[model samples]
Target chain A: MPRTNRQWSLARTPRGRLTTDDLALVESPIPQIGPNEILVRNTWLSIDPSIRIRLSSTTPLGYLPPIRPGEPLVGLALGTVIDTRNPDFAVGDLVSHIFGFRDYAVIGTRADTIGGYGLPTRIDTRGMPPQWYLGPLGSSGLTAYAALTEVLQLRQEDTVWVSAAAGGVGAIAAQIAKLRGATVLGSAGRADKVEFLRQELGIAAFDYHDPTLHESLAELAPDGIDAYFDNVGGDHLAAAMDNLRPRGRIAVCGAVSGYDGAPHSGNPDLFQIVSKELRIQGFRAGSYNHLEGSMRQEVGGYLTAGDMVYHETIFDDLTQAPTALLAMLAGKTIGKTLCRLTSE
Target chain B: MPRTNRQWSLARTPRGRLTTDDLALVESPIPQIGPNEILVRNTWLSIDPSIRIRLSSTTPLGYLPPIRPGEPLVGLALGTVIDTRNPDFAVGDLVSHIFGFRDYAVIGTRADTIGGYGLPTRIDTRGMPPQWYLGPLGSSGLTAYAALTEVLQLRQEDTVWVSAAAGGVGAIAAQIAKLRGATVLGSAGRADKVEFLRQELGIAAFDYHDPTLHESLAELAPDGIDAYFDNVGGDHLAAAMDNLRPRGRIAVCGAVSGYDGAPHSGNPDLFQIVSKELRIQGFRAGSYNHLEGSMRQEVGGYLTAGDMVYHETIFDDLTQAPTALLAMLAGKTIGKTLCRLTSE
Candidate 1:
């Protein structure tokens, strides 16, 4: 086993736009495990936009505190147990936890969870891609499922719009809603992503940048949308409000537009909430972790039938993790963005 | 019966800050009632903020069409049916209908309802003040009751904030929540209204104009509020988001700040909705008219037992309906604002 561990750490809080110098790859001796502890060698890292909220010096109230400079960045990861002192885990066991951006993690039975999820649970890959635990059959899948079923209460008669359709959660949400027989419309920031949504996912897709967003949406749904899966906030949210029917619903999964260094525009005409009698609910998948089993069952069925398209933009090795995050944040990556670490 | 009827009409859509000239008190002949119709002499006019939305040249999509110049304004009014050609009504029957801003109204069996509420219905006043059917025992009361019970789903353990607490809906909402055993905080625009909220309504009260809204709210609810009843939107909503706890809820009843000709501020930090896992719902009381029976039962019990204080800012005669609306909009009036028309 390697004696040294390489981990990504925040060098400084990012300003308007993130730069390479803002992050550092730090080296240290592998952390020793105590009784009831398991040492994991991470094989995959999930690069999510929400972590950007912690890279700043301040976070929104009630959210996790900011990740200070020189501190290791924490996220969802899939790893193998290399050394185990806990009876529940054995060497070679594949597990998922909330200690990522690193080569190795020393986990205890009481490891921290992200909003009640990612509790260092064992994963049985059953010969399928083990990395799938960190993607579609995991948190991303559950997020989409919970938002659609619980928050938006999506119905078959509903015409729903999924924003940021090229991203991790949006892609699954758009496909799942369509699979449930709802008329779905998807929006992405780039032409290629839009094409992927139309051809690969087979949904009505649009580039949010084309003309005005409201006009693009109006051209597609003149009668107005019944529900919205919002992955991007700001203008996207405003546009969704402009096009939603009376008694419309919105499930806010992420706000990628505001998480970056860009200044908040605060442009949404919230009065739409009153006029249209709209319902807007913001949620984190971790809050609904109980739905994970049902999520895996359905998503796994789609994968086995080859009816679902699970795409990934993977960065090679630990050194590329920062680049992967930047690419995802700039809307340059499609589907789930991840870092593949070569386990020795 | 009087041969002439005086009605309030829109002379021109107000540009910014409505003035007396924007509305005109015009004279018209009282129309003869036909079969299935009733001629009512109006006694009370309910001056509400939502009417300002229709006075503009354009309204929010999905809302009722704007009232044009020379068109008579419509609102909820209490009147006595002096002449009836319909079997469902009789002479001297006290009733409530959407035909205010006039001294006399000819109501058809197919009279319009507001958002599915406000249908012309007979009121048994039962020896109570007949005008209470226009104030606490009517639409304003129903609005507050529906917002608290249905929209907010208020709990006894919750600490909720009601904005515009001295106004028609706010006053009732604040008291109803307080009477239900929830810790309530009330906010009003003026110092006198603040005093009324504290001394009369018997709740923790603050002037929204004092210090900063966030500071004032934080001072009272340092731990954080669980639900918010939003009557004045814009900055008030921003403050609520800043001070709400995780899983917080907001019921959007009105946006008095936006309804006037003033430019919208659009200053609320919507990202709070995501990070804090907030739930926001906008509704009109008309949608929950089914709950009106239960609402009147509980609210009426409060009134009979001297547990509720119903305040009214009354203006004599139909000529002051415009002034009453302006006063309510400017936050110059307390509780329910009404125009007491002297019926001939």
Candidate 2:
């Protein structure tokens, strides 16, 4: 058994493009489980861009507090209980929790009930990959579901645009909107990802780097879009406003375009919101935990039956978590970005 | 009786501050009404900032169309039927319609059916002034009601901020929100307008020109506002975004700040929207005609009982319509700005 535990802690708040100097990986001894505690070996770590917001020292106004220097970065991870003094989590039980960037964790909790890392949710893979629990069935999946059904309240035959369509949430959002009988037009960064969307997702996809995004949007959605699932705010948002039909709806999932605190000159003349009668709603999926079961059953079925194909860029070690996040934020990753710790 | 009808026609689209040069008051002989026609004598012309958007040659997309050079400006107005060959309408009945900056209008239509100027529905004033159909009981009133009940869906005990607080819509909105038991803070242009908000409407009010607008907002809303009724949407919008509580709602009525086509630099960071989980909905009351009856009954009661007081900047004649609009746009007017075409 491995007694040494390796973990990454935030070294400093990142200013622009993140480098490894911003995070420090250190080796520590794995703590033994006490009574009513469970010892787990973390096998996978989920890397997300939201972690960058947490790494900001000043901490944005209304989001979660900043992670202090030298504190282990907190995020979702898949782990297996190797040893336990608690009754419910027996040896060899598979679970997911906020063991974070660490390779091992020992948490004191009632063995009979599950703790809330939100997605540590007990999922039945039903012969599918458990990793599906972290991607198509994780926070991204739930966010896509909520944005489509509740936020956008998409009507059949509505034309939709998904920004960051190559990402975890946007990819699924496009598919779900398509499933709801709407035309889905999406924007990604790379040509390969754009191809992936058209070929695999069967939707109109364009690259944001295209010289004429407006023309591309016009060609793709000639009649104009009825809904916009906005993951990239700035120019993408402005373009959507220009192309949105009257009484359009915008489900604001993320602001990746302007997340680094840079000037985004393309903030649309908000008057268009009234003139076009648009509804822009900003949402956090963690607040929609009530819809978890239904989303799991619906999106989970698509994953299980091979009706929905999801791709991910996975790193082999925990040291790659920071790099993975940078890559994802840089729009280099094709799907959900994750770091693999143990080979299942 | 006047043999000729005088109407103001657009001379040119103004580049900056609107002047008399952009509009020309022209006179034409009144045409005889046909058997199906009704002749109307225009009494009061409603002057709103939205007219500026229409006067722009490059019509701001999606709202009302632009007025061509030599075409009369179309808007809401209070008038009376003077001659009707049609059976449904009788001479001397107060009416409202889009007679368009004119002193007399003769139309060929069944006196019974209403035209779609979007308003001028047969309103029962019940001893209240018929011009009330253009102010507190008009589109502005319906706008306030719809914004509070439908757009914001404001929760009780909410702290609200209304920008352009002394104007037609904002004045009524502040009162309605207060009646709903919310702590309402408002911003107007002049000291007198601010005083009107505090003294008559019972809302905490401030002047936007105050050098300490940000400090004043912070002091007024010690915690944070839960909702915003945005009429002037430049710095006030930015300030509101900075001071909104989590899950705050913004009902975007208009953007008078940029109505003159000048650049406004105070657009809020889009990330704050996602972080705070705000819902910003833009609406026009014309689109929400469904709420007319309920709003009239409830708000009408307040107006009849004198529980709600409304103020207006009334111009004495048709020639003042252009100047009244410019004054209203400059925030020089309190409450509704109307050109009183005649004295009964």
Which lDDT tens digits does candidate 2 get at residues B9-49?
99988888777799999999988888967788888888888
The CAPRI classification for model 2 reads as: medium
lDDT (C-alpha) at residue B319 in model 1? 86
- The ten-residue window of minimal lDDT in model 2 chain A covers A110-119
**lDDT of residue A118 for candidate 1:** 42
The per-prediction i-RMS, to one decimal, reads: 0.7, 1.0
What is the per-residue lDDT of model 1 for residues A32-144, given as tens digits with 9 covering 90 to 100? 99999999999999999889999999988867779999899999999999999999999999999988999999998773655765468899887779878878888889889
Chain A TM-score values for every predicted structure, listed in order: 0.98, 0.92
DockQ per model, Cα? 0.82, 0.74
Listed in order, each prediction's TM-score against the native is 0.98, 0.95
Question: TM-score of B chain for each model?
Answer: 0.98, 0.94
User: What TM-score does the first chain of candidate 1 have?
Assistant: 0.98
Ten contiguous residues minimizing lDDT sum, candidate 2 chain B? B110-119
